[model samples]
Target: MKSLCRIGHSLHSRGLTFGSSGNISVRLPEGGWIVTPTNVAMGDLDPSQLSLLDDDGKWIDGPKPTKETFLHAAMYGARRDAGAVVHLHSTHSVAVSVLEDIDPADVLPAITAYYVMKVGALRLIPYFPPGDPALGEAVAGFADKHHALLLANHGPVVAGADLRSAQYAAEELEETAKLFLLLQGHKIRPLTASQAAALKQ
Candidate 1:
C-alpha cells in the first residue's frame, strides 16, 4: 500500500498524470489486487483508502475500485507475468492518439534506444468511451503480445512485471510521444526494425 501510494503520488507530482484522470493497480501475491479508488486523484491517494479486490474482481475492502477495474483485470487475465498496470491520460500521449495517419500497429516510433528497449511496439487500441466494458475486452485481446497500448483519442495503458517498471515504461512512452509530436514535418531518424530488435536482445 505504501509503495502504491508513493509511486502514484510521484507520477502525479511529475505531471505524468493529473486530476483524477488515471488509474493504477498492483497484483497481490495472494491472488487479489490493490487499486486506486474511483475518481481519486493519484497525487492524493490515501493508502488506507485504496480499494482491494479478490482474484475474481469482487471488492473485498477499502473504497470502490476505479471504474476501469475491468480494464486492469483484463490485462492481468491476459498476461500471467504482469504485476502492475498504469493507465494515464497524459497530454502528449493523448495528443498522439488523436492524430490521424499514425500507424495503429506502432503508434510511437522507436526514437530512442530506451524507448525501443523499454516500451517496444506500442499498439493502438481504438477508442471506446472511458470505463466501457468493451474496452476491457479489446485490451485483453492484445495484452499478452504487447506491454503497452495507446487508446485512440484516449491515452496510454502500460503493463509491466512490477509497479516501478511499469511506471518507468509509461514515462518513456510519454516522452517518446512528445518527441514524435515535436518532430512532425521534420525529417526524423527513428530506429529501424532491425536496430530495435537488436536492442531487445
Candidate 2:
C-alpha cells in the first residue's frame, strides 16, 4: 500500500495526472488487487483508502474502486503476467489519441530507442464514454499482446510486471507521445522495424 501511494503521488507530482484523472492498480500475490479509489486525487491518496477486491472483482475492503475497475480487471483477465496497471489522462498522450491521421493499429511511431524498448507496440482503441463497459472489452482484446495502449479521445493505459515498471512505461508513453506531436510536419527519423526488433532482442 505504501508503494502504491508513493507511485500515485509521484505520478501526480510529476504532472502525469491530476485531480481524479487517472487510476492505478496492483495485483496482490494472494489472489486479488489493490486499486485506487474512484474520484480521489492521486496526490492525496491514502494507502488505507485504496480499494481491495477479490479475484472475481468483488469489493472486499477499502473505499470504492475506480469506476474504471473493469478496465483493470480486463487486463488482468487477459494477461497472466500483468502485475500492475496504470491509466492516465495525461496531456500529450491524449493529444496524440485525438489526432485523426494517426494509425489506430499503431498510434505512436518508433521515434526513439527507449520508446521502442520500453513501450513496444502501442495499440489505439476507439473512443468510448468514460466508465463504458465497451471500453473494457476493447482493451481486453489486445491487452495480452500489448503492454501499452492509447484510448481514442482519452489517454494511455499501460501494464507491467510490477508497479514501478508500469509507471515507467506509462511515463515513457507520455513522453514519446509528446515527442511525436512536437515533431509533426517535420522530417523526423523514426527507427526502422529492423532496428526496433533489434532493441527488443
Candidate 3:
C-alpha cells in the first residue's frame, strides 16, 4: 500500500496524471490486488482507502475500485506474468493516439533501445467509451501478446512484471511519445525490426 501511495504521489507530482485521470493496480501475493480507488486523485491516495479485490476480482474491502477495474482484470487474465498495470491519460500518449495513419499493430517506432526494452510493441485498441465492456474485451484480445496498448483517442495502458516496472515502462512510453511527435517531419531512423527483436530477446 505504501508503495502504491509513493508511486501515485510521484506520478501526480510529475504531471503524469491530473484531476483523477489515471489508475494503477498491483497483484497481491496472497491473492487478488490492491487498486487505486475510483475518482480519487492520485496525489491523495490514502493507504487505507485503496481498494482490495479478491482473486476473482470481487471487492473485498477498502474503497470502490476504479471503474476501469475491468481494464486491469483483462490484462491480468490474459497475461499471467503481468503483476501490475498502469493506465494514464498522459498528454503525449493521448496525442499520438488521435493521430491519423498510425499503425494499429504497433503504434510507436523503436526510437530508443530503452523504449524497445521497456515497452516493446504497443498495440492500438479501438475507440470505446469509458467503462465500456467492449473496451475491456478489446484490451484482453491483445493483452496476451502485448504488454502495452494505446487506446484510440484515449491514452496508454502498460503492464509489467511488477509495480515499479509498470510505472517506469509507462513513463518511458510517455517520453518516447514526446520524442515521436518532436521528430515528426524529420528524416528519422528508428530501429529496424531485427534490431528491436534483438532487444526483446
List, residue by residue over 1-201, the lDDT tens digit for candidate 2: 999999999999999997898999999999999899999999999987999998867789999899999889888999899999999999999999998898888888999999998899899999999989999999999998998889998899899999999999999999999999899889988999999999999
Those runs of model 2 whose alpha carbons end farther than 4 Å from true positions after fitting are none
Position 193, candidate 1: lDDT:
87
> How many clashes (backbone atoms < 3 Å, residues ≥3 apart in a chain or on different chains) does model 3 have?
0
lDDT of 1: 0.92
Find the 10 residues in a row with the least total lDDT in model 1.
53-62
Model 3, range 1-201, lDDT digits (tens) per residue?
899889999999999999998999999888899899999999998888899988667788998889999899999999999999999999999999999989999899999999999999899999999989899999999999999999998899999999999999999999999999999999999999999999988
Task: Judge candidate 3 against the unseen true structure and give its global Cα lDDT, from 0 to 1.
Answer: 0.93
What lDDT would each prediction earn against the true structure?
Answer: 0.92, 0.92, 0.93
**Candidate 3 vs. true structure, TM-score:** 0.98
Model 3 weakest 10-residue run by lDDT: 54-63
* Ten contiguous residues minimizing lDDT sum, candidate 2: 55-64
Model 3 alpha-carbon drift over 4 Å, by segment: none
